[model samples]
Target: MRTQVAIIGAGPAGLFLAHLLARAGVDAVVLERRTRDYVEGRVRAGVLEQGTVALMERLGLDARLRAEGLVHTGTNLAYDGEIFRIDMAALTGGSAVTVYGQQEVMRDLFDAAESRGVRIVFEAEDLRLDGLTGDRPSVAFTRNGVAQSLACDFVAACDGFHGVGRASIPADVLKVYERVYPFGWLGILAEVPPVNHELIYANHAHGFALASMRSPTRSRYYVQVGLDERIEDWSDERFWDEVETRLGPQASAGLVRGPSFEKSIAPLRSFVAEPMRYGRLFLAGDAAHIVPPTGAKGMNLAVSDVAMLAEALTLHYAERDASGLDGYSARALARVWKAERFSWWFTGLTHRFPDMDAFARRMQVAELAYIRGSKAAQTAIAENYVGLPMGFGGEPSNR
Candidate 1:
């Protein structure tokens, strides 16, 4: 097989890039190590930034999202049993996030790919990149135990952090920065109405807890736990009890308890692999960076990365201009770092630290109190929560 671009991974980044490139009249093929069912069924984040929604519309894949997505104009913060709402839409000039699951987004992307003429090769295993530094590059992989090769002009590595994409980058050229938090979030999916209309992030003496929903009938909630925690130890009853306690009285009002259908523990961390672009290989999404879920920036960050990557690749193909491609790394990293900071800050504010002294706890409370009382502070949180403008490198947005 041969194409202008060989995209590795069928995740949001790769699929989004495929759609963007196809719309630009560029020929590309996506390769995934897993089947479409597995990719679409994977449980992931549910928050969608406005830019992500815009891209879905730009790619003509928003019909289902528009119909099923729950839009939130505001989000709530709770500490010391008192809850306050942040008017995100009012603060950001009418920008708000959509509570659409990553699974739904993947389904939409896959459903439209064939009609839109984007090709994807699933179960492509042992993928290898050859001649990345040279103008002529190719990918070698296996499908059904048969060896195959795809020669392409460029490679987009969106296969995620554990995949071969980032590993292919030379050690000397890649620099990694990572912070693994001491705690993890034990979350559950229950078929019950959400306690509140808007999502809530609660900080208590116990830990951090979040109240969220996948739909009007499905609730998604999380409570902070130690890294040593185990899933078997957290029964459905125990989870409900703990989450409600951390949420406190006000936020936990009307909290409904039911049998949890899905439960898992997710570790928190902030990781960034610098120089997102090396030779003809550009890493996107979790392949390049990871933000703690505190600010709900994971998938949104991936969409933004691929948007920039798509623009760079489109410019390269459309105008024979290499400026965008040349500036891709610095440009994408500009936004990546800002998100990293916001996620880190938000995590610190709402999560209990193992080493937190009394003064530190008081400081966290003081900050939250300040944000509650001061419009300026609330404005800052609201803007970051809705996602900063798609302004890369501080110039005007072409998006």
Candidate 2:
């Protein structure tokens, strides 16, 4: 097979890139190692930044999102038994976030792309890219126990964190930065209703806990702890008690225990790779960078990378202008680093450290108090939470 672009991985980044490139008159093929059902059903980030929603709306992918997603004006910061609501819209000039699962967004993108005749090969394995010379690069893979090869003008590595894209790059040409937190989040999705109207980030001496919901009828919650904790070790009774204790009495008021749909532990980390592009291959999404879920920027950042990648490819194919393609790394990294900083900041604020002495704990409490008391501090949090603006580097949206 031959195409204008060979997009590896059928996740949001690759799917959205193929869709956008198709609309731009570019032929693109997507490959996924997982089945369609698995990719569309995997649970992931649920918060969509304002810019993300706007981009989806423009692409005509917002119909189902608008119908099913919930919009939140702000989030609550609870610490020291006090609750403070930071009005995101008020602080960010009417900007707000939508609660829509990444899986759902992927489903919408996948359906739209398929309906439009975009090629997506699923259940394929051993995909490899080689021979970067000439106009068409070589993509080798196996489908249904049969080997095949694809040649494309450009290759997009949107596979994921453990994907081959990063590994393909020469070690000397890359600089990797990473921070693995001592704890991971024990996440659970319950069939019961949510305990709060909006997402809440709770800080306590025990650890950090997040109160978020998937929908009106489903609640998603998390607690910070060691990554080695097994799901079998946590009983239903202990889980609710830990949630109730950390979330305090308010959470207890509306708490309803139900069957847990998904329960897993996710480690916290911040990782970035310099110069996200190499030769004829461009990396996007988790293939390029990773942010802790604290700021909910992982999926959004991936989508944003592909959005820019799509535009860059369009310019390269249509106008013969390499400016956009040349600037892709710098442009994407500007936003990536900012998000990394914000995620780290939020993670540090909420997570308890083994070395957190009495002085450090008091400082954290003081910082929380100042954020609650000062409009400026609240605005800062609101801006990062809602989203930073699109294009290169800019201030977080104040509207």
Candidate 3:
């Protein structure tokens, strides 16, 4: 097979990149190691930053999202048995977030890609990239016992953190930075109306809890747990009890309890592999960086990364210009680091550290109080929560 670009992984990053490349008249093919069902059913982040929503709308993939997604102008922060609201829209001049599942986003992108005749090969195995430093790179994989080789001008590594993308790069060329937290989040999706109209982040002495929704009828909630915690030890009844206790009586009012249809424990980490591009191979989304879900920036960061990647690729093909492609790493990394900062900061503020001393706890309380009381502090929170403007190396946004 031959194409202008060979995209690895069919997750949001690769799929969106293919969609953008096609619209730009660049040919590309996507390869996924899992079946289509598995890819679309993976439950992940649900919050959509303002820029993410706008990008989907531009791609004509927001028909279902705009209809079904829950919009929030503000979010609540609970600590010391009290709830304080941050008016995101008011603070950020009408910027807000949308509650839309990552599964739904993939479904939409998949549907759009299929309808438009973009090639996606699922169930690919042992996917490998070759000659990334050369002008022409290629992807090799096996599908149903048949060996296939795809030649392309560029290779996009959107295969995620554990995928072959980063492993393919030489250790001497890639510098890795990672921080694995001592905790994880035990999350569940239940078929019940959400307890509140907006999302809430609670700071309890026990741990951190989050009250969020996938839709009006399907509530998604999470509580911080030790890294050693196991999902099998948690029962539906116990999960509900813990969630309610952490949220407090007032916030848990009208809390509807139901068996969770899906449950999982996700470890928290902040990881970034510097210089997202090496030769003709470019890493997008989770393949390049990861942030704790506290800031809700995982998928949003991926969308922004690919948007920059797509822009660079488009310029390369349309005008025979390689400037954007050359600067892709610096441009994408600029935004990736900012998101890491926000997620790290928010995680520290909300989560109870098991090893934290009295002084550290006191600082957490004081910071929460300051954010609740000060307009400037609230603005900083709202702006970062809703997302900062897309800036490429301090250049003014043309959007």
lDDT of each: 0.93, 0.87, 0.92
lDDT of 2 by residue, 1-399 (tens): 888899999988888888888888899999898999999988899999988898889789999999999999999988876677899999988989999998889888987886777899897799888965345687899999999998888899999999988778889988899998988999899988888879989998899999898899989999887777888988777888888778777645677877787898888889999889888889999999999999799988987898888989998989999988898988888888988999999999988988899999998989998898899998888888888876722323222
What alpha-carbon RMSD in Å does predicted model 1 have with respect to the real structure?
1.6
In model 2, the Cα lDDT at residue 174 comes to 81
Candidates in order: C-alpha RMSD to true structure:
1.6, 2.0, 1.6
TM-scores of all predicted structures: 0.98, 0.97, 0.98
Query: What ranking of all candidate models by TM-score puts the best one first?
Result: 1, 3, 2
lDDT of 1 by residue, 140-246 (tens): 99999999999999999999989888999999999999999999999999999999989999999999999999999999999999999999999998898888898
- Candidate 2 lDDT: 0.87
Clashes of each: 0, 4, 0
* Candidate number that wins on lDDT, 1 or 3: 1
TM-score of 1: 0.98
The residue-by-residue lDDT of candidate 3 on 245-316, one tens digit each, is 999888898799999999999999999998899999999999999999997999999988888888889999
